[model samples]
Target: MEATSSGRRSKQIRAKKRIEQLKAFYIHLAVFIIVNIIVIAGAVSGNMNNGQSFGEAFFNFNTFSTFIFWGIGVLFHGFKVFSYNPFFSKAWEERQIQKYMDADRDEMKKYS
Candidate 1:
């Protein structure tokens, strides 16, 4: 009974931590959107003040550079929060470990 209770507590703690990570990632995304909007608006206005047309100012790379760069960081953060590793997952690692162990066993049988 105590072991089950402890296991449940451990799982609860891990879940709480995961929830916190998700919340932090969401906050980061919100801040990224808010800040980028302000930055883009400022850049557009600055460019227009400098005599560029509204369309040119709005479409300029400088106007969205911060959004693009910071968005990359936000995307990475989201991926990390969600455990989205394309190249290496827990199942993949386990399969690789099993494959190596089987190969070693086969090699040992040949030696025997």
Candidate 2:
């Protein structure tokens, strides 16, 4: 049937979109890790050259700040990729649709 084929196509499209999202998330994670490692390494080396101890250099705020900030972005990206919206879920969408439909019915009743 046409409806069955359309449903299958819709599912395929959604699956493809999900795969793309996952791929993008992985790329983002890789970049985050690689860049943070470079930044932290530079910070540590610079600090040690300035006479700081290894532990002090490695654990400095400046050394880890990039990781912390970029990690926040990666966390948000993960949430988006994983479809982790708590507020605007399917139930919320259905409720909003029903609410609007009820409002429209009430307005039509007043006109009739």
Candidate 3:
């Protein structure tokens, strides 16, 4: 039936979108790890060149600041890709549309 084919197509489209979201999240995670490692290594080397010991350089605030700040961004990206935000969901949009329609109807009734 046409309805059955339409339902199947809808499901396929949703699955494809979910797959793309997952792929993007994975790429984000990989880049976060690689870039943080490079940043930390560079900071450690720079600190040591400035006469600090290896442990002092590795544990300094400057070394982990990039990881901490960029980590917050990564956390938000993970939430956007994997979690549902009820405030912006389709159901919320539908409810807002109905509310506006009801308000418009009441205004028309008042005028008439």
Candidate 4:
């Protein structure tokens, strides 16, 4: 009797994890936008009596401007990955899955 390979299963798990990560990233974006809106709204309702510039008062997504640069970065990365050659992208994922499968096969062979 032979044991079935778990590569496909492992790939599924990896894909699921990636999806969750993507979802979390989008959630962060949503929160950021909403929070910024509230902040800006508060600033708008109040007089500009604070001893700081507008740029200094609000959260900026710009890299040179704030830490939000990373969020902007991976957002574009996700955009480019989705926009350019989706077939190639899927192929890359499949290849990753197969590579995991093959590694498992090799390991099992070594044990047997």
Candidate 5:
């Protein structure tokens, strides 16, 4: 009975945490998407389209930078170059979990 209850509690806790983490992840992703749209729109509005070459356009040193190109390119990558996680990365997942846990503390305290 004791073991069963402990397992159940653990499962519940894990589920709650997972749900919170997903919420946080979605919130971050939504904001990122919105920001990306705005940035792209601004660039387009300013007639910031393609350059002389694809390389020059992507690695715009006189503008954003090649570093930015790599940064965005590898936003969801690690270990291998081609095979990589993009949206919800391991580091990103942990960060979002922490963010969610922090946000839920007050609500948790109320229950406690």
Candidate 6:
């Protein structure tokens, strides 16, 4: 009974942690959108004031550069929050652990 309760508590803790991660990700996304909008707006206004057309002001690299660069960080944060690690998954970690353990065992055999 105690073990079951402990397991349930652990599950609750994990759920809470997941909820917090999701909340943080959402907040990050909101900030990213808000700040990028402001930056793009400012760039557009500044470019237009400098004699550029609306099309040139709104569609230029400088207008979207912040989004392009900071977007990569936001994407990585979202990936982490969502547990979408393509480079190092649980299976990959398990394989790495097994590989190291095998190496240790081989070293022991060499000594024995």
TM-score of 3: 0.76
Model 4 clash tally? Answer: 0
Order of the predicted models by lDDT, top scorer first: 6, 1, 2, 3, 4, 5
Measured by TM-score, the strongest candidate is: 6
Off by over 4 Å in 1: 103-112
Residues 1-112, model 4: lDDT tens digits: 1233577777889889878867876776777667656656566334234554565544323312333554476566567534555556877989999999999999999989
Question: Model 1, residue 28: displacement in angstroms?
Answer: 0.3
Deviating ranges (above 4 Å) for candidate 6:
none
Candidate 6 lDDT over 1-112, as tens digits, reads 9999999999999999999999999999999999999999999999999999999999999999999999999999999998899999999999999999999999999999
Q: Model 5, residue 100: what's the lDDT?
A: 94
Taking every candidate in turn, the Cα RMSD to the unseen true structure, in Å, is: 2.1, 1.8, 2.7, 9.2, 13.0, 1.3
Better of 4 and 6 by TM-score: 6
Estimate candidate 1's alpha-carbon lDDT, on a 0 to 1 scale. Answer: 0.95
Question: Candidate 5, residue 17: CA error in Å?
Answer: 1.4
Q: What is the C-alpha lDDT of each candidate?
A: 0.95, 0.94, 0.93, 0.63, 0.60, 0.97
Best candidate (score: lDDT): 6
lDDT of 3: 0.93
Write the residue-wise lDDT of candidate 2 on 1-112 in tens digits. 9999999999999999999999999999999999888999999999999999999999898899999998999998998898787879988999999999999999999999
lDDT accuracy of residue 71 in candidate 2: 99
Residue clash pairs of candidate 4? none
Model 5 off-target regions past 4 Å?
Answer: 48-112
Per-residue C-alpha lDDT of model 5 across residues 4-99, encoded as one tens digit per residue: 999999999988986776666566556666765666455544544543445444344443443356446445432233335666688998999999
Query: What TM-score would every model get versus the actual structure?
Result: 0.86, 0.84, 0.76, 0.43, 0.44, 0.91
Q: lDDT: which is higher, 1 or 2?
A: 1
Tens digits of per-residue lDDT, candidate 1, 31-100, equal 9989998999999999999999999999998899999999999998988999998889889999999999
Considering only N, C-alpha and C atoms within 3 Å, which residue pairs clash in candidate 6? Answer: none
Q: Where is the poorest 10-residue window by lDDT in model 6?
A: 77-86
